[model samples]
Target: MQMPKRQTDDTVAQAAWLYYVGNLSQQEVSTQLGVSRFKVLRMLADAREQGLVRITVEHRTARALALADRLVTTFGLTEAQVAPVGESNTDDTLARNAVAILASGYLARIAASETPVTVGLGWGRTLSAMADNVTGVRNSALTFVSLMGSVTYASHTAPGDVCVRLAAQTGGRAILLPAPFVTDSAAACDGIMAQRLVREAMGVARSADHAFMSVGECREGSILFQSDIFSADQIQQLRDADVVGDCCGVFYRADGTVADIELNRSTPCVQPADMTRMDTVLLAGGLGKRAATLAVLRAGFVKKLLVDEGLAVALLAEAEKQGK
Candidate 1:
């Protein structure tokens, strides 16, 4: 009788290894090893079942992870997490990923709570993109707050648009903050604040069970700068102050400390102290946004920050290389 044929040890090992390492797809393994795709899949399943393949996800951005730790230690954060910026993609994708991750974590926290309620939404394209990425039961009684009022013109979606989106995703009440982003007179802002509806919304914010926001920068196209709101002098003042970035209309100076600016002349929004109190999360990335990113960090607004590899590496290297 012919001797029984032993199983191909190398084939089994290769499939198992590739499944764990992410270097090869089932198709790739099948093509290389002359096995059917179905067989490869089966072998991978067997690998997992038989304990030959195990998976542990290390954070993709090791450098960012380390930097986040250092930042958390230096800044005393509640917690910090970082994601990798894909080598082949733009910074916006990386920023969105970080935002999604942070949002997901916060939503998880809120979901586990008893009272399903009140969430404050920070407006901006970056934030709206994040809201777009959010889905499924957020809260039974979710409330969205307009972190700030409206921008000047341009017809872009309002910041409260993020609130609306959040409400839809998590199934809760979204409180829209409706007042102009900036005003010609201080009285105008005071009058808006005096409105009973706006007051109630602000009160909801004060009792915010969860607050979601992105840092703002004063660049021409920034959420604040480009919203058709800021005037020439206001824009010029921001430039003069070397204000890099902000969160919830909060600006910061070049040394990574909060910079004094003139944005609050129009709207009374969340401050650094309130931010320090809440479960604030920040999302920022991109090679070009180094100044803004650094400004935000120094401003000390982010309790939890989400960042990507390109910007993280650039920020770390720039801070290290040039000592800015």
Candidate 2:
């Protein structure tokens, strides 16, 4: 994600005008230019050195640019968006809404891209909110595949339902994984994976050009805990292992290492290693999910992050404490 040293003069001038005159943030410029915010900062600096911009306009990007730079440098991320949830963020609910709306914009841009797209998705509340807000597009070449199995309830957080809704919104096809997020035993999981439809779903997921997912905290307010998908003893065991959060159904500890638990075997989730191959966008927020979000970031599973300011602050603080 390093900034290029050789950028066109026009590009640098445009970036300078956007930051100093147009009153747009670096994130907005990054989105408009299809480049990283780090690059935009570099371009602005270049503009200053070349005497292209002579005046400074008080704009929001100044603060957002600082935070985004720190996050990308600290986490080694390709891109990071630290969205302002609101002036007052006492409960983190507003932050979640802002993140969902922001994610919808990102999804719409991706759907409108020129190249064909096959997006892989994992289920969670943040992702569900994004699906609800996503602007419908008529891109027949875009396809969505559920990266994990489903929950029984046909709700927003279920993989099958999320994929279906996203596909419907984008005017594409949905390849849902027809199985539970977790089965009674590993043997049952294997039986479902053996099905042709399930195999096809896996193939589609693995072939995705872009992937979107969210982290799940293993706590009282977590969707997994409330869904009754796992027994109380199992949840307790995860706590004993210091399990912080899960991405695509793979639980990991605070240090970002995968937990060696039997529950993973009982779920037909995509391998975490495979996710690193694509452009992965992780959308998550809330103070309650701070630890889990940090864990997923530490695991190096995400290339781009879309998070609220509260969680972004917590992540940077934790990363600094851990010497990340």
Candidate 3:
């Protein structure tokens, strides 16, 4: 069959534009649109900014969005959100209860029925316990992804595994990220990201509707070091930077300026801007995490904070003391 004349010209323009204007490779464009690599390159160089693309973040308004609002203002989040928890008592119980609530609440907030949702999860004993506590679940099609890998067998399943279990409950999909939380060198993280699974998982994390995470102590390793994610040297470095705690695996100063660490480049768990992409950064965990969570709030990563009465009181008291 003879190729159409007009079609040929369009494809070339599109590929060239993708390459020059969009900073995308011919291979990536081709993969996204199911076109040949040659056409992708050609069109990328030639495509126009006006007609090449249109972008928007779809917001699904909900009651939760309102609660998310109050917290966002209190915490000064770019976007805010809240999740309803299941019943609980123990600290771990409260933590998991929150996840179930978060799951149900996230489902309620989706205004579109067809959009793909990806979630980045950090692991803590509290988060792991939350998985077991999830109840009244609704979503089954959501994609749950792992944000970091494990240094020990005990950490194998991770949030990826928890996502799998939660997905099973909701009938959703689970995408696993393969790289330990901390490594000896940044290059090691870069090497791991080269894998197909790791790359795809990161893409998912970037597009999540909202991220549900807990605070991790940095001066020491919180509960994570027990899992072997960090070494003595890494902890010492955090101490040097006056890192009080961490959010996910990202260490930060009391102000949350991601302390210059050795593992960012190869294994960028997520940037503050990256986390800001979502409308909400739901912060969970307690007591052990009060200082860490507050620093993250001051840095403006989290839009909403979910905590128990006891911790809330402690935070107020701590804040007041600082004021004095």
For residue 148, model 2's alpha carbon misses the true position, in angstroms, by 0.4
The model with the greater lDDT, 1 or 2, is 2
lDDT of 2 by residue, 117-232 (tens): 99899987788878767754678888889899887767767878888888877788888887788887778889999999999889889888888988888877777778788977
**Candidate 1 lDDT by residue in tens digits, 1-324:** 233323554567778877667588778888887889999988888766654654323445566567668657655567766665553346575566565655555565676567656666666665665665554455675567776675656332466767776677677666766677676545667788889988887777766755677666667666567555667876776788887776665567777666555555556565566655567776665555667777666666567766665666566666666653
Give the Cα error of residue 243 in candidate 2, in Å.
0.7
Segments in model 3 whose C-alpha atoms lie over 4 Å from true places: 1-73, 77-114, 264-268, 320-324
TM-score of 1: 0.71
Among all windows of 10 consecutive residues in model 3, the one with the lowest summed lDDT is: 49-58
- Give the runs in model 1 whose Cα sits over 4 Å from its true position: 1-64, 86-90, 152-157, 220-224, 256-261, 318-324
For model 1, how many clashes?
8
Q: How close is candidate 3 to the true structure, as a TM-score?
A: 0.65
Model 2 Cα displacement at 254 (Å)?
0.3
Model 1, position 202: C-alpha lDDT score: 74
- Give the Å error, residue 92, model 1: 3.1
